[model samples]
Target: MLSFRMLAPALIALALCGTGPASAQSFTDTQRGDIEVIVRNYLIAHPEVLEEAMNELSKRQAAAEAAKHEAAITQNADTIFNSPRGVTLGNKDGDVTFVEFFDYNCGYCKRAMTDMLDLMKSDPKLKVVLKEFPVLSQGSIEAAQVAVAARMQDASGKKYLDFHQKLLGGRGQADKARALAAAKDAGFDMARIEKDMASPEAKATIEENFKLAESMGMNGTPSYVIGKQVVVGAIGLDGLKEKISAARCGKATC
Candidate 1:
């Protein structure tokens, strides 16, 4: 016969195996066989509690990583917009600064251009910084060159913004010929604009914009850095307005 102590462990295992309820428990030979099979199958299927624990732990780790990314963006308010290549529009000494990274070929950027113009017109104390991030195609680079060349013609911020709007707003690609034609339509000197497009300063400025965009993790064409938030994609006019308003109170540089 099994000792009482040894039988106690077997009885407890049998109870866990559903041989009978712990309270007033009893088992027949058939019940004992079924209980043994149940226990064996369970042990085989769920052999490692450690694996389940690890899976739960991995889920927690991924959540923590996402939170950390959000926090990092929140803390980057000053560094993103205050960089050297950042442009200022509206009020040079405005209470709010909205920085946008855009490509000449991005349709969403063209759509947002109208909103930007409207906002500038509405708010004199709003400063807008435009960063040319030409990531779309080879044609985008040509468009950026012409736009930067137009800026070199001593045009006002309004002209730059207008040209930006038109170039992005148009159909077809913005190749060199198309960009120069757009410049002419914007009242820029076609001959001088083409010559100046190849200047070292223009190249340097575009390179700087590229570097800044890369630093801020701006892989896409239409990304905005408002206050401490790095908003990716074309979130429309209202979304931009809200971000700018929030930036005014929290952190203006970024």
Candidate 2:
């Protein structure tokens, strides 16, 4: 009676016959059917084998995804880390650059906003870049356009960050009107923002963000590019710090 674990290797080895119709010639139909029957019965008796196999598969997939992200980060390092299109904050000359793509209308981005602020507050050596990635709706695009316009007048990112907090943290839908309200409260020159909003810069900035995000496989708000790692979603503050540590010292904690 062969155990599930014992049959696992055989199942994995049988994968060789799946390359193509020509390559599958190595295993005759009868032989393949016998192996499949044995493996299927074992898997039924011990379902943990399926779990173990899936876990291994997931590990491989994650590793492959991370490698792809690293490659994309390397290829676009200059634009991703140093492009003037993105609003730079925190230590500009820090050891690690953290780039975030967010849509103002996203609820997760609102919550993740606190985590970003906390990271900047806690880590003096962390540099932050904010890019507008408005994939949510027409209203989101409108808000992002306003945000990019606000970034134009505020080179220091003080007013822009304040404006960002207000738009993302505020209640209800984030359209041009709501964004305009937030910009006013942030004390931006309203006339200047309106003028900039209709300029090519605002449109180009958002377009560039979309291109960069698409290249890196980022399709959501609050996706982060920290130290060559493309982290999707808000993994919380501790997860962020660990990524920073890994980037800084080549480990999750340093």
Q: Highest lDDT, which number?
A: 2
Q: 1-254 in candidate 1: lDDT tens per residue? A: 22334434464474566434653255566766676666556645765643674688789997775465456555554555555445557887788677788888888888888888888998788877887788999999998888888777753566666676668788888878888877877788888897888999779878977766665567886887665566779888777877887777653323
TM-score of each model, paired residue for residue: 0.66, 0.87
Please give the range of 10 consecutive residues that has the lowest summed lDDT in model 1.
Answer: 1-10
lDDT by candidate, in order shown: 0.72, 0.91
Question: What value does the lDDT take at residue 123 in candidate 1?
Answer: 78
Error of 2 at 175 (Å): 0.8
Q: Which 10 consecutive positions of candidate 2 have the poorest summed lDDT?
A: 9-18
Stretches of model 2 off by over 4 angstroms after superposition: 1-32, 41-48
